[model samples]
Target: MSSRYQQGLGQDASSLSGPVRQRSKQACLPCRRRKRKCDGNLPCNICKGYGYDCEFDNGAQSANLKRPVPSDGSPQPGGKVTRLTYPQEHPKQPTESPFFPGILEPSKARYVGRYSSIAFPLYVGLEVQATKIPRLHSFAYHTGIRKEPPCAVTCEAAQKIPWNTARSLIEVYTATVHPVFGFLDMDQLYVRCEKHWHGQPQDLVFEAMMSGVIAMASLFSGTLDQDTEMWFILHAKEILEDCVISRFPSLEQIAAWTLRTIYMRCTARPHVTWLSSCTVMHLVEAAGLHHASEFVMQTTGNAAPSPEMFNIVNRVARVATSLHILIAFEYGRSIITLNGQILENLHPTTGAKDLTFQLCSLVAAVPTNLSGDALPMMQELFSSLDMITSVTVDHDFLLLLRADLALGIYRRLRVMDSKFQQGHNDRVIAAGTAALPAARRLASQNRPWWNVIGTVFQFACALLVMDTPTSCERLVETMDTLEMIVDHLNTHLAKEALSTARQLVRASLDKKRRGVESLEHIVRDASPDSTVSDTNDHLPQDTAAMSPSLTSQLPLDLDSLWAMEFQLPL
Candidate 1:
């Protein structure tokens, strides 16, 4: 009896209270926010069903269950008290954007659009497929943003496009974009175009690839008709994106993505385009294009390489490398590689001597702080690029590379002779001045084929206009030129870039009028290369001197708007 009593004393008194208790799962964040019941599965059925963020409240203390109070109104020795109650969350009536579901209030809707189909799947896995979707478009059924719209290119429309019209788009691509960046063999693509013109069943991947190429050609053709050019790109995007989700992709898939990536960069979102480019890089590596030498040896150890296989291998390596470099440079950063260095032989070349050397120069010019004059490098680059003046010989990728080169040099010009701070030296200003003719020439040549390309144009124009102490006339002319090209474009991005340019122009004009040394407000207030530009945008300080369109009325009654925005549900 004594031994048993001693043993009982040694055991934990808390454990003696009862058997181990079953833990009640904490409610998911969405369920808690919406006041819905949570089933507590990994996603919590409520969040999984509605497709909301399902993170848990880490701050809420875990509720430990204990033995219930004795039936006789005597509190047990180790009774648990549920102390993790939050203040009765007077549930706020969650307001949604009246105009666009994925969008916020009036101000922010312009850049990111109403909803991000990209953000919806991001919380879920990247490759998670919606197996039970009813609609043809998977995003509609899964994320439930909008109804599945009809395909842009219907069978009827496809039949209606004359073989001649289709042939013309192909011709445009061949004449303008090819010879420099040749992904598809012109002979084979021509044969396919001929076959499609006869109304035969082409491979779906092939059709998508062809659609993208034609769409790209149309944009550069300066035929601003939305129907003929932009429609083809949009239709092809749908088909290609669907192919990415539903089908086993091939080299055609790579080409299809390159088209989409380029279209997105020009027309809409730059960052999304960047991400897509990275995905293309990964896909290229996956397809063994990186090790084509090994691939040839593995398949045909004792035999000479077929011309067909060698050409395919060469094009893929070149396209993948150039696209990766250009995309990285576009976003204003050098490549951040974690793995060991790439093989000396493995690094892809741009194929053209002028482009290849300039590409190397751009890569070498990455260290942002150089004490010496950069004018020689800039001159050398321009001189090198000058060899190919004829647009007839210039490929589309080379054109983009040229603009990108201008963008890099323009950025370098801004950083000239100034320590860390963004200041314009007289020499730099002179360089900026010299760049104006080149910038204008480039804009005229490209005619705003891509979205960010317009921004590049805007940056150049603004720099030139701002560099002058008294060039209001030039600024007006610049605005007119920008409007003539960008204003005609259909995408919201064009307007966004134009607006940025105008703000800088207006701000610079204001600064000149006031005779201020600092261009701080213009730099601080402008949406230069932001992922999302905000609506709480400031008017130029000297707004009274500015145009009526440049100045708008702020709300006279802030309280009312505040009250409406800050209300909570009972």
Candidate 2:
């Protein structure tokens, strides 16, 4: 061997002369384990590289120092070798030998359960402490924290204990306390397996159990608390970020479900107060309907939703729609009346147009009966009208027309009796009439047929409310407006306006059922499906046959007169 190789071998030549020498010359044990090269050092360069507190076995050290010397000055069985060595000191006391009298064989040590007695008291104390802490008490209500109060207590206790004690407690708790809470507290159950026994082959078993528990809870409850909702959202988002988004795309399902449950609960009632409109909108966009549908399909299992479930879901959807409409209307109203900065930042025409279209769509979707909740909803609609009419007419003139017509019908029928209480009819009618002309003027410019029809209807309603025939002249002017609508009703706009006209006509006929024969004749002639005949051409033939004295003395039926005055068609 070269002097360099000889120098590489330690002076304890016998110990260096076997497989140990080969390994040391090639790579030190630490370096070999790390799969790296070793530089000659007391602690090999690899051990230093890895920052281990390197140690040497005393038997190995002694053997290296006792190698035999060769008689002929040639290399002998136990070769003379020089080795790199670290500076050291000799001990003042002799080291006790590991050998024993009986030469006891090495075997696996048996655990004698040293701390078993303390386990019961320790568990009891943990339970007491967990129940006492307010924060932990709140955590118990959390969906995944731990179902069983005691398990959560144990978990809290385990966190504070010494490692060996904690390990013992955890093992005992997992075997005993875990079964009770495993179904209740997912976080505690998961933490038990994840934190206590991590890195062992049993991690997959715990993970599968946790996944099962979570899946079951989601299936049954169909919801979670606010904090749990947030936790799942964040946790699932992280998992997707680390493993799913780019690589394992299928795992995106987890993130998708987390978001869907959060949204569903956020929008559902009782908890509806827990989330705002803006939050729900953002979550819905994030969850994406397709993903939510998939999650529902997968999780909703064999127990089909009961009638109550459907009702609850429908109610939630309706409420959400109402809230959205209310929000949009509030914005539109602010723009019109307050001249709010929100409007200044927006294009008035564009903003109004968008809001009007949305409001109309919402109105169309809102159920007409709405389970007798229509009054509050109508009040909200009318409030919007009051605001919009104060602004530029172009913003919501059509909506105002429709709203006024509906309000008029509502007041006359006493559908919302509370609104007209204490003789408030005159004020209501006056405010409504004052708001109509501007709306009518704007509607006439853009939608003439509707404006004329709506104007005539309002005029008739006004005349019916008037105390004297002096107001009959206003009826003459309303007749002129009706003529324009009649002209279009004979043309193409009939189909579009027919339903509204028919409803108005029906109300009028129902009111005037016992009035003058001429009124009854006019009602019989009005048909939404057929064009109106010229009443002027037929009037001479009809009126000549009636007795003037009888007509003069005829007391009009209040309902029939009201009905005839507003007659259009059903």
Candidate 3:
């Protein structure tokens, strides 16, 4: 080789001046900025590697770049480069639909963005698709919370209350809660349970009866700490769990669950209440209480049960059935998959001037999920609303509440039915935007707790999922308003709800402002042996991080079941 160079009259190796630098035209623009090795292929390896809209320039000229890429072509010890090549720069063709830049294959991109198309099902982003709930750190349990059945607790606290102490609590309950629940009989409770109250503290029915009274009294008192409510519920639940584990089925067990459901409702745990309500229904059916009339006839036919005992079980069954129907409606679940027979036998126990009876009538009149003629359903709901023209101090506390709930449910049905309609969307936004403040106002004016807060919150969530600027703005406003009133809520359940609402709002805002880079959208690819750098952690200081917790928190895996239950704050 030396002899050939000498023969060709080339300059000596010493005179080459250290390989002579290119007087400075170097890597392409993207490679220069990313400090990556450029293959100099018009869309350089680095640009192509990151799905970036790559362009190029020398000292004299540059051209248009469109990208679909992996990482740069720079050599790592075991670097796995996905090399996507494209035509050399076409000066006339402009790129379209540029999304946020990312690393890896499109599916595994670190900072993935929404897929855009003129006519196809859009993937909002592979990242966003990963966290279906958009983890806003809200108190609302993600669908994956393993809800174990109720556990056995001694409820040493509940059993210790003296028999004499229950009278006032019972009075408070009869005065405040019974009017709404209507699932218990005061005369029978006072007459038949007095002996158990003074003597048998371990009696399940006695514990349930006192728990209801104490819990209701605590709630209606209006100033008790939220834990006090849970304490009452925990105590009551322990009592019932004892009966349930024993597989005991009785009219007393039915009454206990009715109280438990009421407590759950009062505490904003409607899903829990639904669970309790189903138990009540199960017991009702088991005891043949649902066939109250037949049971009465048969028992009378045998002369084995007194008419009074027969009437008690019959009324308890009737009220429990009514309550079940209402919960089913509120939860969008069909009760017993209601049919001609069940609907025929269905009636609200006819002994109370309370909200349950009113709701029972409405439930019997309007089918769950309202799939029939909209005109008739709307008219019936309106008729129910008309029955309560004004809410006065004398009015039952739950009257205006469940009425508002019916209206909210009606609106929800509208949102579901006309989802694609612009009018429906607009009305929903308007109603949800206006509704939360009204709820807060009502809570302030009357009671701190509203049975329908969950409905309103769910509606607000619906608005947010719409993903429009209007929806987002309304959600922010709703969260801000809820924030102001959250502290006033006396129960931890409702307080936790407002706190979670704020978290979700914050998460939504981060998602909106940061595009699709939030960590909730992070997807782990199939590469078991590959290690990817934290994409956002390496982000330049100029751009804000989408999720600060990206490095620490992993997006949780969940089922879609929790999403449905999220309709309530449970």
Which of the numbered candidates is closest to the native, going by highest TM-score?
1
Write the residue-wise lDDT of candidate 2 on 56-100 in tens digits.
455543443343321111111111111112111221211222221
Residues 300-339 of candidate 3 have per-residue lDDT tens digits of 0111123333344445666677677767666766575322
Sort by lDDT, best first.
3, 1, 2
Off by over 4 Å in 1: 1-160, 222-231, 242-249, 292-304, 307-309, 332-403, 409-447, 451-499, 512-570
Give the Å error, residue 224, model 2.
54
Scored by lDDT, model 2 comes in at 0.33
lDDT of 1 by residue, 1-570 (tens): 111212322333232223333333565676566555554434443343234677766543233122221111111111210111011113222222223222111111111121345334422331242333121112543766666554344332256467777778788777655644555667777787687768665666567677777777767675437766666666666676663332343566677777667666666566777787776666555443443121111110112223343344445445545555566765765543311111112233345543333333333333222235567655543433333221221233444444444445446544553132133223233332333444455556663445224434544464554475433434555466566656445456567767877777677668677765356656677676662465444435566874343344442235644554333448
Best-fitting candidate, scored by lDDT: 3
Pairs in clash, predicted candidate 3: 48-69, 49-70, 127-521, 143-562
Model 2 stretches with alpha carbons more than 4 Å out? 1-399, 402-413, 416-424, 427-474, 488-570
TM-score of 2: 0.23
Model 1 compared with the native: what TM-score?
0.47
